[model samples]
Target: MRRIITTIDIGTTAISTIVAERQKDGGIRILGVAQGPTFGMRRGSVVDIDEVTVSLKKTIQEASKASGMNIKKAVVGVGGTHINTYNTKGVVAISRADGEIAEEDVRRVIQAAENSIPKNPNREIIHIIPREYKIDNESGIKDPVGMTGIRLEVDAMIVDGSKSALRSIIKCVEGAGVEIDDFIFSSLASAEAVLSRRQKELGVMLLDIGGGTSNYSVWEEGRLVQAGVFPVGGTHITHDIAVGLQVHIDTAEKIKLEYGHAIPELFSKKDVIKLADFGLNGDDVYLKRHIAEIVEARFKDIFELASKELKRIDRFGLLPAGVVLIGGASHIPGIEEIAKKELRLPIEVGKKVNLPQPTDKNLQELLFTYPVALGLVAWQVNQLSGDNRYFYNPTFESVSSKIKNWFKVFIP
Candidate 1:
């Protein structure tokens, strides 16, 4: 059985796409991967449908050329400030003559959790994942089916997003001539590619720092505990540089990528370079230390908020596996030190993908940054195999292929 899936991860700065062929052993072999410019988006939400649609089309076409595979449908990853998460519990009476909780009981309790969601037509629930189960006096149960209990309960993590924002993204994908097979929260998708089961079980935090927003999620005892999106991201650093140096946005971006450092102390007073040295201008000269200072302050703005959020949950410095940083912005040279100093935890940039991956040199080196896109393809494989320990996948039923008889379901 062969299962090939394509995925698109839309960020404020860029759009990432992946075409992968799932092997018989349930591993992903990347056929194609590409990164393209993103426009008409801010903080992960679509601001201009027309601009995003055009960008999506070009990115998909590029991926097709790279993989030599026709791209038609894709699993999309969604994240932004408009997305919200809640930790909630649901209760129900078990329906069994022997007082044992049945499969239906579990389903009913989960539905009850969904019912706890506040009624907002403007918002749609995208993920309703079970955190733990409780049977009467017993709590912290991972699985409750067939357990003897009169009362059944479930603690679930619910993620919902602005309906209008989601619609705008869907319209852009469809406008690009690609059907949406399924949609997932961006952080959840990243977790699939970089986070391991051991990390989840021991407690870990993943921060996916993008251009416009920093998306973070927490897992404890192998369940989603908390998650959120911060409006601040790497773009803030670019803006700081542009304002400080009186440079254009494009120049600021280039400087940030090529010479930006998170720690100012790493540079010396004599370590200065002129614009002409970077092929920009012949006269203007600046200190690299100054550039690093601008970058550090903007990052402080991001990490301060993150620290506050961790304090709210009482998980600061608590995760044994510490913090795993992914996404495009996390690729900066000395970011882990900043993360460690502010977060006060053991921090390491996420690398070393577990998937049976592509051999392209650039794509192989960039695999860490493409977790969300890679995870979307992995999501499809997990769906077929009933692997719910990582993410509870809601069916992506709309515009799904009308015929499903061609591929045999491969279960590992």
Candidate 2:
């Protein structure tokens, strides 16, 4: 029997599920995928338990029908402005009698790091990533296992979220009769889909623009360096267009997708969009420039915030791989150009690469918007089987293993 893995991406605008089989060749064969309008989630946090539960059931059922398999567990993606990271350090005395480091000693040191998390009744640690290790006062050690040292120290990054918000998501998933195998940050999952090894090594920023929010992750030297979420997203642009054009939300969204351009200069004055059918019975016909102006304004603001974040991290000058844009909002016309201009960095639209060429029109349409969901599936399989042939590792895997072993004792 083929081992199956499922991943759910609960976003501000939609909830998606993907079930795939782990093939012997280390590639994932997508068995089924399902999506529904999201509820109970805003800017990546669960807000309504009942609504989230109902949405999860709908998507899971759809995926089950297509895959012909029952999914009992899943890897879920989480994001929101409520999510934050802190830098922490920990030290421990080595217990090895001969003063030689062993696996158990390494495990203990990592546990010490995790145990040092400050107690916050409102927040819970979601992930702990060790940035570096020190052996016996000697710093810059990446892997301390098997190294002789009397003391062990570690620098780590702790990702935490509002406990109530996280519990709500977990309760909804469990209420749907499935366990969560793991939870990854939303931007980290998106980074798995679009970033190449070279980009991570040279430093890269990934921005996933969903319906209600935009999520970001920065990678450098083959490790996740930072992650954050912005409360604004593609939905804001639609709202702007709606208000600017004096049209309904649905009509505004349709116009934004069909005629929206982030750069006005790229569009010609001769270009026109028909608004008569849209019930805009006005003497002034809708011009492409108007739509571009509305989209550009919102998009510029989003990119400006992203730039400010980079500046705060002192990473503004270091992203040689520039910015990679993905998710539902990335489909807007001229987005790549707008991002390049506003962020002053090289920009590219993230496209799904590892799929069979669609032989039908319907499949092609589905492929375009579901890259994040598909990428989530890819990440799930990779984590379960330990195969990441596509990317390079800048950090020692031993560190991840040590952290995972320690976490299992508490989180499971």
Candidate 3:
């Protein structure tokens, strides 16, 4: 039987679905992709299950029809203000007659780290990525499966989300008649799609600016150090434009996309455009520079908020790989230059590069707004190739087996 994977990205602005097949030579072939306007979501969290389910069903049906495959299971991306992340460490004695670390021992240590998370009724752990391992007195070890050690320890990053929010997302997907393979953090998924291995190793930050939220993640020494979601996003810029120019939201959105720039200095003050060009039904003309000022203000706020997060983690302006911007808002003219100036770091707009072959030109355009969805499928492919027991197949044989596999993380 041929192996196929599908992924759904439920974002604030749109729902994206992609289906791909794993080739015999370990390459991925894009079979189909679809996207539609998302509803009942704000800042990446589902507010209405019925509306989200309807949108999801349509998205999945479109992709399935295009790919000529039934969409039964998929990995989903989740993000929003409800998401929380932090670091923790766990230690345990190797349980063996000869003091040798084994695969079970690794699992135990990770379990120990998981146990350290505070049990809160409102919160649930979604991801536990092992950052590094220490065996006996040795530290900074990536793998110690066959090594002899009396003491085994691990440091990991645990991603948690609001229990109610998670349940809402799960219920919506299940209602759409699709079973979820797993839930991945939205920013982490975007990072998987756009970031190079070398950038992660050299310390980098990824900012995915969507419609209602800007999700971010920092990586250092080949491991995720921090991840978060900010409520401000491209929609805020549009709102600012609407209020400043006294135009409808739809008209403001069109203007922002057609003429917006993140740095006001790059635009000419003398260049005036009529509001009627954007169907605003007004005779007044506005200078491009004034419009850019509004965009620059919002962009500044987003970058400064991200800078505060880096400061809190003591990694501000320290990352050699600097900042990589992705998602819908990343297309704003001069956004990268503004981000570099605001954060005092190197900046680049991120693009998808890990796909082995993508035949559809439309797929390339969707990749910008659908990185999280594409990353979800890419993540599953990596897991299967690496022989991940938890996600080896789409369905589990029993409840016990499912429980055992459910909590596994992407860290190796």
**For candidate 3, lDDT tens digit of each residue in 185-245?**
8888787677878998999999999999999999898777888999899999999999998
Strongest candidate by lDDT: 3
Collision pairs in model 1 = none
TM-score per prediction, in order, is: 0.91, 0.85, 0.91
Q: Where is model 2 poorest over a 10-residue stretch in terms of lDDT?
A: 390-399
Superposed model 1: Cα runs more than 4 Å off: 355-366, 393-412
lDDT of 2: 0.76
Q: lDDT for each of the candidates? A: 0.81, 0.76, 0.82
1-412 per-residue lDDT for model 2 (tens digits): 7788788888888888888776776656677888899888777888889999999999999999998989898888888888887777778888878888886775676667767766775666666666678987698666677888788887777777776677778879888888877666677677766677788889889898888888888888777677888889998999998889788899898888778788888777787777775666655567798789888899888899999998898888578899888877787888998888777878887764433222223323454566666666667667656554222111223222333444456576
Q: 1 or 3, which is superior by lDDT?
A: 3
| Reference-based TM-score, model 2 | 0.85
Clashes of each: 0, 0, 0
Ranking by lDDT: 3, 1, 2
What candidate 2 gets wrong by more than 4 Å, as runs, is: 98-100, 136-141, 268-270, 277-284, 352-368, 386-412
